[model samples]
Target: MYYAEGTHEPIIAPATFEQAKERLRKIAQQTANRKKPSRSAFSGLIRCGIICGDCGAFFGSKVWNSTSKYRRVIWRCNNKFKGEHKCETPHLYEETIKTRFVGAFNAILADKDSALENCRLMQSTLTDCSGLDAEIKSLLEEIDVVTELTKRCIAENSQTAQNQEEYAARYNGFVERYEKAKTRVEELHSIKNVRQAQADAIGAFMFEVQELDTLSEFDNKLWLTVIDTVTVHADGRMTFKFQGSTVIDA
Candidate 1:
């Protein structure tokens, strides 16, 4: 293969070309080592997150050699030939799987307008977190009040000689209230973080969509950023799940 510096405009940017070269180099290394099985081109391009929906096992890649012209790469359930009961999932060719992904992704792009609008609608509720902010503020105030009460109780116990049993009870009550309030605050913060993450994920999807008119070929960078999971089932079916929870099937 020859790569010459082109005078005409390049189809891919220089950085993208370098990234593709790196990916190819890594995948070449993976395929060279057959002693300990590594991933195939599909898994390498998409990362190691493919799942077998039938046996709930991870997928593995394999290469079959007949001749130089007839050599092929395929993927199958890792546990298919391991145990008494074999997984029923079918082996998939590398090109077929990649093509299916392109179809699934392009299907989403086909409805890009509606999908962006839907994301915006969902973001309206997820990003508008004034209610959660107010609740967090109220929780923080309660925590502060409980902390002050605990401090006051400890100070009283240290200053005045009181009944040991009564003083212990009062201090314990304040301590328990303070801990409960702190726990509540932590829970509320966790809820807020989840909402923020959802909003951010939707925003990212919208941003990527805005830059695309249509995809004529497979985009490695876009695939990595936009896809979350690719699942294959026993019934010769494939599903692509995007980052923002968009699912397409092949």
Candidate 2:
């Protein structure tokens, strides 16, 4: 079942693998939580959550034979034939997507405890902002030092007949230092905020996983709570990415 055991060259380099992951990450961030009401359980998720693997486009929902004896609800790439090139990926029926999702859910449920533990560990790691906090604190202290120097420079210039040009230069240098330190502190705080948001998402996913029992059907509520995105490959394979960035290929 293993692809390789280091006895041969890797199918893909680590850098390439990371680049693909980064692209997927950006797409997931843009599409996750785009909840739109529709007839399908994964309606809103169809055009956003379920993505085309070959062309990197969202799958739009389509309903055929609406007024006939047989009706078909399918999802296909939104940009299938929009450009000069066309996507070779096939469309997925709602029933098929649901069935695959159920299998993926059960597979994860089979390792529920391990998954929950890993999520908790990840949440803990992301929530810990000690390093960023320390850096921010140091920058704030530097800003305070620079502020005091600026005040001293101004006071000395006013108290005695000092060269205005030299005094202005010193004051401007202090101001520049203070501004840089303040800007760095703001950037660090922004980074901490993003980490905390990720931690919160992991915590929410963990809570949902802890509450669920055996999953026999596709639960819309649970799916929304756990699924961040889904990728449908050209070969009819589907990969479900749950909250906390845990992925299950089915």
Candidate 3:
């Protein structure tokens, strides 16, 4: 009979010290293999992009002096570092921007009416493009009619029912007009899509704003995640606009 550790069985037989040690070592190895490392709460929430409004440049961060007394995380403008014009704004301290962004985000999130108003403003701005879509559709219809006329003129010319030179000139004019209308239609369509995307982006940003708890909870990653560009005015006013807003200033 054998007695296991911590068991209430009768100790009719006992293992040698070496045998007990071997059993404990095997148990330890099994436990180690089954255990998993703990994950960080914010492991997946990191932003790697920063856009500048003044110089239209992007900045990235790098950690420096990992073991030094002054361990630093630095953000430098890629343009200035590449011998581009000295950007007027200094290399921003990551902590400063992080603090400001959190505050701004919190303000937006706290006020339900304001967030909805921002969404409405974006929708209104995009509504201006609605007429352009209608215009493009009408132009497409005109092009179709002109194209049919050109085809009819070609057939009439082949049958010799119409003067060849006169039919050819008319067809060339119709082709030219059709091409111009088609180009205009394409341009308007592109503009319409752009406006629609902007509207959608604004709607999405509003939703994100509604989810945030407080300004201080905003992380550096959240700034890059939510904002398109941040403009600092001459009057010390900072405006942060998302992709869809006409103007978002703080």
TM-score of each: 0.70, 0.72, 0.62
Model 3 TM-score (2 dp):
0.62
The 0-to-1 C-alpha lDDT of every candidate, in the order given, reads: 0.73, 0.78, 0.60
Tens digit of lDDT per residue, candidate 2, span 1-250? 1111223577886335555676698678646645433567666655668888989989998889988878778899999989998898899988888889889978877888998988988888987888987897688677767777777888788899998888888988987787788778768866776776677667778887787766788777677678888998888899999888788998
Order of all candidates by lDDT, from best down to worst?
2, 1, 3
> Which wins on TM-score, candidate 2 or candidate 3?
2
Compose the digit string of candidate 1's lDDT tens values, residues 27-58.
78767744555445355554366788888787
Off by over 4 Å in 2: 1-37, 63-73, 153-175
Ten-residue region with minimum lDDT total, candidate 1: 1-10
Judging by lDDT against the true structure, name the best candidate: 2
Write candidate 3's Cα lDDT for 1-250 as tens digits. Answer: 1111223454533223334565599678557745744232222122223555456676555567868988776655556555656665455555555666666676666675766786787678785765785786688678778877887777777886777677778988988888788778767756666666566566667666667656655454455446766654334345666554524455
Error of 2 at 155 (Å): 4.5
